[model samples]
Target: MTSILQVLIDAFALGSLYALSALAIGLVFGIMRLINFAQGDLITIGGYALIVPSSQMVAELFIGDWPWVAMVPAIVAICVAAALLTERIAFRPIRDADPATLLITSFAVSFFIQNLILLVYTGRPKAAGIFPGLSQSVTLAEGLTVPGIQLVTSAVAIVLLAGLAFFLKRTRTGTEMRAVAEDFTMARLLGVRSNRVIMLAFALAGALAGTVAVLLVAQTGVLDFRMGVFLAVYAFFATVLGGMNSLVGAAVGGYVVGGLSVVLQAFLPDDLRPYRDAFLFGIVILLLLWRPQGLVVGKAGRERV
Candidate 1:
């Protein structure tokens, strides 16, 4: 029982991280029919923003040295700025382009950010002592222990999810965003400012990415140029698994993916552990085959009469 409980806790924590990332991706996809692959780069930017740029392997804390109250908001702000800038410079001009074009543009932006980081920070990973105290383990029961970071991650996810729900349901801007997502053309005709709504979605997505970056760096204490890649990939899959058209589905999908990953890691033989992702994805493929539309089927896209 204890062992099972431990597994469940671990799964939930990891799932929370994936859920946050998936929500980020889902937000942008909801507003624009574009799959912003560069969302990962925004996360990477958030992590890198914490430390002073250096070619040396060890990263010196810059914004990271500030109190958490100030530090987190600063990182989020930086990512939001980056997201908005990308929208304005890279995406806005080509807003009416086909989905394929938008996807390619996102890839281009991702490569640009990655190479720029390599030029300034080098290819080596940097050790960052971000929120080192969170690494400590906390005892929950006689035989059960949980990492502080995991607990924090779960709590943060819950709060953010609830907060986002309220914002979307209660606020005028949020309503506008929802309308835009449902039918961009109709929404625009009905007085929704296209650029404003789209920019807000990207900004919100960036904030989520920034938050995930902090949680990830706190958990791993290492910064790599590719740190956000796996997270983004998994989140993207989660969005598809849950239902690309629904933000709620994205969140649910994140938890599902996270839970499956933990379960596989625990049950697989030691020798097979290295191939866990392969097996896990194989299972995901099977599941998708069973339910290609996703666990939650979103409403069909509206058509203009």
Candidate 2:
């Protein structure tokens, strides 16, 4: 029972990270059928934004050294601006392009951000000691212990999810977003300014990515140029598995994927443990074959044009 509880904690923490990441991707994908590969790079930018770009072993904390109240907003603002800028510059011209074109554009954007990181940070991983206070584990019920990170992450995710749900259900901008997600052409015809809606989506995605970066550095204590790339990938899978068009689905998918991963790690034998991803992916493939529509299908679920 204790073991089960521990696994649950682990899963929730991991899921929280993935859920945030997936939401970042899903937000952009919802507005434009384009997956922003640079979403992960936004995360790297947040982590790297912490330290002065250095080739040396010890990284000098940049904004990371600031008080928590200041540091958090700074990261979020920077990344959100970056995201909005990317939409304006890189993606705007190709807004009407086909999925294949958008896919390539996303790849280009990913590479572009990575190259910038390499040029600045020299491709070397740096130790990031952000929010070290969260490292300690707190005792829970019946001798069980949970890492402060796990609790914080889960709470953050839940709060964000609730806030997002409220925004989508109640706010004007949120209504525009849902309208755009439902049918961009129709929404544009119905008085929705496409550019404004798209910009909002990018901003939201950037905020989510920034938050993930903060949590990521706290969890890993290490920063790397490509750190967020796989996270972006998994989050994409989460969106697909949960229901690409549904933000809630993406969130659920993140939890499911994260939970399944911990479960796999716990059950796999020592030798097979290293191949955990392979097995997990195999399961995903088979499941996809069975339910190609995903676990949760959005009302506007069909693949958009």
Candidate 3:
């Protein structure tokens, strides 16, 4: 029972990361119907923003040395600025383009960012001591030990999810966001400023990306150029699995995927352990075959304004 409980805790912590990433993806998709794959690069940017650009393995920690009070807001601001800039420069011009065009643009922008990082920082892994103090573990009842970082991850996830729910349900800007997500043209007709709503979505997603970056660096204590790739990929699957059109579906899907992946790893036989992801994805395939539309049904069709 203790082992099972431990598994559940691990699962939720892992799920929280996926859930946050998926929410970022789902937010922009809701507003623009564009899959901004470049979000991963945004995570990379967040990671790089911490230390000064250097080819040396032990890159100098710049802003990362600041107190959390200052570090977080600064990194978040950088990501937010990048997101808004991307929206204005890349997405706005192609607003009327077909989905395929937008997708290609996203890929282009992703590579652009990746290459830019390579130019600035070089393609080398660097050690990062992000919040080293979070490494401490806490003992709970029944002698169960929980990592402090995991606790922080879960807490942040729950708070953000609850706060997001409230923002979407209660605020005027939130209502505008929802209206834009449902039907862009109609929302604009209803007096919702399309640009503002879209910008807001981008900013929110940027903030999520920044948060993910911090959580990842804190957990791994390492920085690399491609760090955010798998995260973006997993989050994409989570969004699809949950139903791309619904934010709630995205979060639920992330949790389901996170939980199942951990279980598959924990319970699989020795030889098959290496193939845990393969097995988990095989199950995902089965799940998708059974419900291609998604675990939760979403918008029937997306129409352009």
Best by lDDT: 1
Candidate 1 residues lying further than 4 Å off, grouped into runs, are: 54-59, 300-305
Worst 10-residue lDDT window for candidate 3 reads 296-305
lDDT of 1 by residue, 99-145 (tens): 99999999999999999888888888887767888889999998999
User: Which has the higher TM-score value, candidate number 2 or candidate number 3?
Assistant: 2
TM-score of every prediction relative to native: 0.96, 0.96, 0.95
Q: Model 1 compared with the native: what TM-score? A: 0.96
Global lDDT scores for all candidate models:
0.91, 0.88, 0.89
lDDT of 3 by residue, 1-305 (tens): 88898889989999999999999999999999999999998888888889985565446899999999999888888889999999999999999999999999999988999998877777878888788888898887686788889999999999999999999999999988988888888888888999999999999999999988898899998888889878899889999998888899899989988999889888999999999989988988899999887787655333320
Judge candidate 1 at residue 37 and give its lDDT: 85
Per-candidate clash tally: 0, 0, 0
For residues 149-212, write the lDDT of model 2, one tens digit per residue.
8898999999999999999989998998999998888998999999888998999999998899
In model 1, which residue pairs have backbone atoms overlapping below 3 Å?
Answer: none
RMSD of each: 1.9, 1.8, 2.2
